[model samples]
Target: MSMIEVHHLPPGTRAGRARAWEELYATQVERATVTLGESETGPTLSSGTLGPIRLVRIEMDSGLLQRTAEEIGHVAEPAYSFLLQIAGQASFSHYGQDCVLGPGDMSLCNNAVPYSYTAHGPVELLLIRAGIGTIREHLPSPEQFCGRHLRAAEGLAEHAVGLSQSVFFQLAADLPEAVHNRVARNLLDALATAFAIGFDDLISSSAVLTGRHARVRLFIEENLRNPDLSPGFIATRLKVSSRYLRMIFAAGNETASAYVLRRRLEECARQMADPACAHLTITDIAFGWGFNSAPHFARSFRERFGEAPRVYRREKLAALATGGGALSAGATESV
Candidate 1:
């Protein structure tokens, strides 16, 4: 959570300054070519890394950043850039959609796809990067939210932007690992809400089914600590057929059971990483999160995070103690 600052270029020739700017953009963001405007000042970037998420704040004169098809091929895995406009304006284009982003507005872009951003005069933005796995854990179909304007200054979108900005600029650098994980979770939840609102037309067209799906998810979240929270139990409690419950989850390419297991595991991981929960044994945390069988939780946790739960907790705690971040094990499909 420690911020690293990249200030203006050192006194040098114009060509040298341009090269320096290009290298900084490539490293801080994605592999892209930067076209600087007619100005002597270079952009200022402040960046921080929290686990799998990377946050960056950029302030610069008008310029263009282009990611070509070849650059897309070079990416090792799918990821996303959630951009929040802090000052001035910027335009973004990706996957055949284009939109202008003004202050207090936000948008998401796929890093594995060809995209470009052009700044109008001076602009400032906070960009949050997460692997596709992390994005999918929060947003079912993340791609649908890409390149669309998510306005702040009112409603849920405003809260999401404010949280993002606060995390980027105000997080105490020494927060516990659990706090960092929770902050990331809450931010993503807010973004998911805003993204859903961005799809008003789709929700309106399928209002009944969408309403049912929302109810199902809310029920699951509220009862996650209940070991009996199964698909059959959920269907019965919500007055929906098991077949219909499956159908609702199918729309998101996930099974109701899978979602439950994923969430439970996430909760267990959060507790395990928390120092306040250090009094609780790993098995206690698992059981509290509705994981009944120790062996089953072990296997599933390994598969999901690419490590045993105890090992993950140990490494996470150790990293936090030393003021460093640890990467999550696996990634999921693109948005």
Candidate 2:
């Protein structure tokens, strides 16, 4: 939650600055070959962790950085970096695509693959790194967006960059952890929207359907606690026909109602297994996720999870307490 201020490595000589810059990139950013065009003025970096995302602000002299295929194998963890060009221009090459981004432009860079960027001049950039798994859930075919310049002065990209700038410059370090997490989530949502809009024409129709299904799933998850949540409501809210909505969900081989019921039951089982919900009764937990009838909820939960609600909860919780359960983390549904 605390902002990490990485002071410019004591400015003295070009050699010292170059070494400092290398060290900073190796530690703060991903390890890559950094060629400094003007070694006298080393790059300045300020970084921090925002929940599951990491943010870094860098101002550096012109340079070229490369992450080669050989280097990628050594990467301990793979992530996607959303780079916003705030000043100067840069050219990026990745996935056989090349792009040039000027001020108020952005691009998504995949760290899992080889890529390179060369700055035309002194540059200031905001780089956000998040787990690929976390971002892939929201944006299908993330690879298609990589190395493509997105205009930050228009549409969702503008809003996303603006919000990120506000957090970088205006937000105080003392803000609560929850507030920082919320900001990070909002930023991701904006970026997802930007990518979705920017690549609309480039993606195939099936991809568009997948994207729509993802959005519908997100809507359902957000409104899961509402008893009145239904496919019709979702279609109206998303500005699509109920019939079209069913078609989208059908791509995943499930009806909208079935998906909703499955998700509700899964949510109930999740809460029942969570220690934080220990004080809540089985019926309370079931109703909390919009299950109207206790018996029906119990039957559905058992059918999905292979045990009675109370029994499953007790066994799962006990296993967790003893560190013996194969309780897998839930993955976001993908179409």
Candidate 3:
């Protein structure tokens, strides 16, 4: 099948246009219910895929598109959809957060969760969807940014918005798969930088303890591959006492050690579910993500995920081979 396609309803009744768009969305994106006003015009969509990344541009009159919990369950894989407001305005609600986005603004949606978008008037939007593994590969704890409005005029976010617009414009062009893949990767990197910088700025301006917590979290995320990553080592590197480090996590109602272990296990789970890591053994994934003991890793994996590592990997692979694999609910939940 071709990697790109455009969809526009023929001159017809508003009802006809709504039905057409509903079907188009289900095929190109996930299953969504599109509703149009009686006097509104039809919607137009142009979509393209680059590796595991999907790019879409949509324009329409006042309307709404929603994906409910049931609809979310039907999705084949967990992903994150980044939305950029190209023109007009739209209201988005997800994860107990709501925001109205104007031209140049952006927002994120976790596809595994229920969400809705309402276009106030004539609106144009550019959206990019990437798999969970691909997203985690770039951003640390992406869920924190989901549902928050990202102003395009901000520091790195401005650059990210520009990059996203350029990428969307390039999606329809005839290009080699390798070129598309490279562009997609670069886009992810730019977005990750924007998110990281914004998050850092937010925490840096907070109280001293909060700032230290943020720094420690970033440090752990960056060093998850190091088998020696531990609370004591992190405290040493940050020039803080071990007790103080523990106190920071305690203030957040979690232990520093527990936080580190959870992050490492989550990273391991992500890599195990990714097809690119198929060549790596389960033990290798555990060790690479800071688990020093195979037996301990196995016990923890089962305790947290409710299954043995080998069994989990095998099931994921089998489901993937049949094109029906769905991301586990535990792995896809917002961090």
Whose lDDT is greatest here? 3
For candidate 2, the per-residue lDDT at 54 reads 86
Cα TM-score per model: 0.58, 0.59, 0.60
In model 3, where do residues sit more than 4 Å from their true spots? 1-3, 38-40, 201-335
* Location of the lowest summed lDDT over 10 successive residues in candidate 3: 326-335
Candidate 1 pairs with clashing backbones: 133-332, 143-335
Model 2 TM:
0.59
Q: lDDT of candidate 3 vs native?
A: 0.76
Q: Give the clash count for model 2.
A: 0
lDDT of 2: 0.75
lDDT of 3 by residue, 28-131 (tens): 88887777844555688889888768888898887788775458658888889888889999988764457999998888787766567889989999888898
lDDT of each: 0.75, 0.75, 0.76
Clashes of each: 2, 0, 0
Per-residue alpha-carbon lDDT of candidate 2 for residues 72-165, written as tens digits (9 for 90 to 100): 6678888999988888988886543468888878898878666777788898888878998888866666766776789876568877887787
lDDT of 1 by residue, 171-274 (tens): 54554666777777777778777777767775665666766775576567667778999999999998889999998888778899999998788667765765
**Model 1 regions lying over 4 Å from their true place:** 1-7, 172-178, 203-335
**Candidate 1 local distance difference test against the native:** 0.75
